[model samples]
Target: MSNSPSRSVIVTGASGGIGRAVAERLAADGMSVLVHYAGNPATAEEVVAGITASGGTATSFGGDVADETAMANLFEHATTIFGGIDVVVNAAGIMPLAPVATMDLETFDRVQRTNVRGTFVVSQLAARSVRAGGAIINFSTSVTRLQLPTYGAYAMSKGAVEALTLILARELRGKDVTVNVVAPGPTATPLFFEGKPQEVIDRIAGANPMERLGTPQDIAETTAFLAGPARWVNGQVIYTNGGAA
Candidate 1:
């Protein structure tokens, strides 16, 4: 592995939940983090502040991961601020659950644009910009295997992400870059529990084998492993769920 001292990482959707947790965790591990948020600059700033306050290095930037130009600018900013990127965690995604019959085409398209296209835009930039021994960690969900009825659109988007991971791993065969995906099951993010009744949330939690919903920190630990010491592990979608899938 490349023993570069500056170890910089870029994390998308860093304003909340899994993204926020991953950014903080990576920074704590002594990696300079670039926290990327699509909106909510205040939340992004808060994440940066928390990391810096804890004696970790972090900076926040805003850009839509779905837009190639915006993603390009994000990469440029990272290079300017931290010299270069050594890892990228693509954590930007949305899960709007609606049965296929009732799901609006526009909503479906939005999900695809952000989850699939956004991941592609960022992963490609990571591939081109990150140093030789860098790692690219993409987000996926265990819903693809669970095959829930209302999650068709969301699962489709993540399915594309899984395919992208496999192909990117092959494409970067000799460059020493590792591309992998982390699939979490029923994480307890605001996005997951938003607007749900207490009983509904309880049932969802009970459904998991662990009898509790996953925390952002749980997912972050997996990301940190993939991003850092687990260099031998590559081209695999490691499911970090507590056997829920």
Candidate 2:
């Protein structure tokens, strides 16, 4: 990692939603960004274009987050482009809601592959390569605490992610790199709304004290804090939900 004047960050799943918001917010904060997408180059390019139009520095990359070689290549590309990476946000995750008993093995395994293995791969690279003062932000979910039905597989995957992130934080001691998990509640994104009925959404939105679902910007603010000044907040899962759990 180079000691550049401005920081550089890699935001996986940054083509849309919370990841996209994080990438944009960090770029607005003056860090060069590498927007990463799993299967969507066009959306990633849109994100990059938006950042560049706003006078921020950004580019796009595509890779399978769960694939070790692909993610390793991603890290190398970021280093090659930005001189060095200072922050890595493991925001790439997939949530497939299903009862553990009824869910097939394929779905459950897919969830783990993307949410757990994906985070591990990116985090491993970040742990070794991120600058001394860098940070690693991993995504979890409040469903782990809520224990909601139909969320068993998703919650289990996120649970693994949380554990991995916390342990990584301790492992990175003396390296000045902070590792933390951001567990969000029911946020209004395509991912959250997918296949969920309107009544279910309304009920969830009203369950929180805020009486509304969390927006992508709400999550992004927390991420920005972690990636920048919240150096002491390590090894903890900060829930970004509106008091939902």
Give one clash count per candidate, in the order shown: 0, 0
What RMSD, rounded to one decimal, does every model reach?
1.3, 1.9
Give model 1's clash tally: 0
lDDT of 1 at 3: 28
TM per model? Answer: 0.97, 0.97
lDDT (C-alpha, whole model) for all candidates: 0.92, 0.92
Q: Per-residue alpha-carbon lDDT of model 1 for 1-245, expressed as tens digits?
A: 43234899999999999999999989888899999999899999999999999988898999889999999998999999899999999999988889999999999999999999999999989999988788999999998898977899999999999999989999998998899999998898999998779998898788877899899999999999999888899999999878885
Tens-place lDDT per residue, model 2, 1-245, is 33243799999999999999999999888899999999999999999999999988898989999999999999999999989999999899998888778999999999999998899899999999998889999999998998889999899899999999999999988999999999999999999999999999999999989999999999999999999989778899999898876
Query: How far out, in Å, is residue 179 in model 1?
Result: 0.4
